[model samples]
Target: MKALFIGGTGIISSAITRQLSETDGCELYLLNRGNRNESLPANVKVLQADINDESQVAKLIEDLSFDVVADFIAFRPEQLERDYRLFHGKTKQFIFISSASAYQKPLSDYRVTESTPLANPYWEYSRNKIACEEYLIKQYREQGFPITIVRPSHTYDERSIPLGVHGSKGSWQVARRMLANKPVIIHGDGTSLWTMTHNRDFAKGFIGLMGNIHAIGEAVQITSDETVTWNQIYAAIADALGVKLQAVHVSSEFLAACSKEDYTGGLIGDKANSVVFDNAKLKRLVPDFVASTRFDQGVKQTVAHVLAHPECQTEDPEFDIWCDKVIDALQGAIASVKGR
Candidate 1:
């Protein structure tokens, strides 16, 4: 099988690339901007080109035909349009990486299946993804473009410990707070249920969909069945670091209004709500798909990896100050109400 991955080295797609490279008779080509220094499998080749430059992309893959072409970075319909023009007849399958956050916000149902209606009025990012899906479905219906949509929710790898809030410094900052026993901010009272999938486990279901005919014109969310609360997730991380959990629960609405713009989309619009994914569709399609990594186990590995590496401990003084400000504001509000 000949496969090409556009923007392969990401939180989710990196695992898929690793899997594809090791698969028997699978020839994988990574199309990226030659930036990140990920040690990919030796057999897997690199096709260096900027996907945004239509001419460059065309020239790069002009002579090659692939059995599967999975794009991991395309977020808009225009990019999908470019993909349709480029790989319409060149690839057997074109997989688009969609987001589970694309599902309806303030959802009508907490359980989301592939059939769940795609709508997110609160976030333009999800709205754009919804538009992209619509464009691909149109292409599939009208032009016979073979397309499959795979949605992933809160998927983490060895490099990251997935969390509800990271301030502005990213996951390492939250991990730092945990290590220092400082109160880590958790949005929405820390009770909202969330699903976090290890990228290694996510690879199993996604690789099964490669060159899979049943996946054509279908949308499937590949995630672990394991569900945990934001509080539990934070505790898991804290436990991994051998520290006590110090969590400060804050309102998601307040976080959105006061924090960065990403809070509006990445938090209130998506992670704020509890989501239970019905991965029965993925299971039915790929019987071998299993997400075996428990949060406690995966989180331990992530924390260990970050601690062992000096580069992963990213610092953000501004974000640290922001967190303190938010906590202070919450405390001030409480004191005023109590007449203290």
Candidate 2:
């Protein structure tokens, strides 16, 4: 099989790229901005160009085509439209990476399947992804444009830990708070169920559908079947870091409302609600697909990787300060109401 990945060197797609380039019996080409110095296998061809510049990409890949072309970075309808124009007849499959967050917010059911109605108003990011998926499905139905949509939820690589209450600086800040024995936030008493998939495991199900004809015109969510509460998720990370779990509980809505960026979408829209995915569709399509990594196991690996690498220990003083303020204000509010 011949495959092409646009924006391949990301947290998720990098795993797929490595897997394909190493042992899929497939010729792989990774097109990216050439900014990162990730050590990829030499056999994998790198297309160095800005994909946003259509003319530049066209001139670069003059006559190239593939059995599968997956775009990992496209988040909007316009981007998908560009892909429809570029790879319409050039590939056997065009996979659009969508988000499980695009699933209906305040879900009607805790269980989500591929057919779960897509609607997310809290997060513009999720809405944009919903729009993109809609556009692709439209193209598939009207023009027979071989499209496959893969929705991923909270998938993590070795580089970062997946956290629902992370600050603007990303998961690293949460890790730092853990190491420092500071009070890390876990939204809404830490009881919402969420699933996190390891990148390598996610790659297996994803790669299985790369050249699959049955997957065309289909939407499938690839995620771990194992579900954990927000409390357990934090405890696993604390366990991995060999530290006492110091979690401060806060409402997701309050967390979002307090922040200038208003993470209501990521927090309230997505992670605040419990979600258990039915991967029966994924399994029916790819019989061998199994998310083998347990949270207790996967999180330890992530924490170890980040701890050993000093470069990954980047700090977020601003977020740290904000967390302290939120904690203090909550404490003060409680005390003042009692006339303390």
Off by over 4 Å in 1: none
Per-residue lDDT of model 1, residues 188-285, tens digit only: 88889899999999999999999898999899999999989998998888999999998899998898888774888998789999999999999999
lDDT of 2: 0.90
264 Cα displacement, candidate 2 (Å): 0.7
Query: In candidate 2, residue 256 scores what lDDT?
Result: 90
Q: What is the lDDT of every predicted structure here?
A: 0.89, 0.90
**Per-residue error at 260 for model 1, in Å?**
2.1
Which segments of model 2 are wrong by more than 4 Å? Answer: none
Clashes of 1: 0
Clashes of each: 0, 0
RMSD of each: 1.0, 1.0
Ten residues in sequence with the least summed lDDT for candidate 2: 34-43
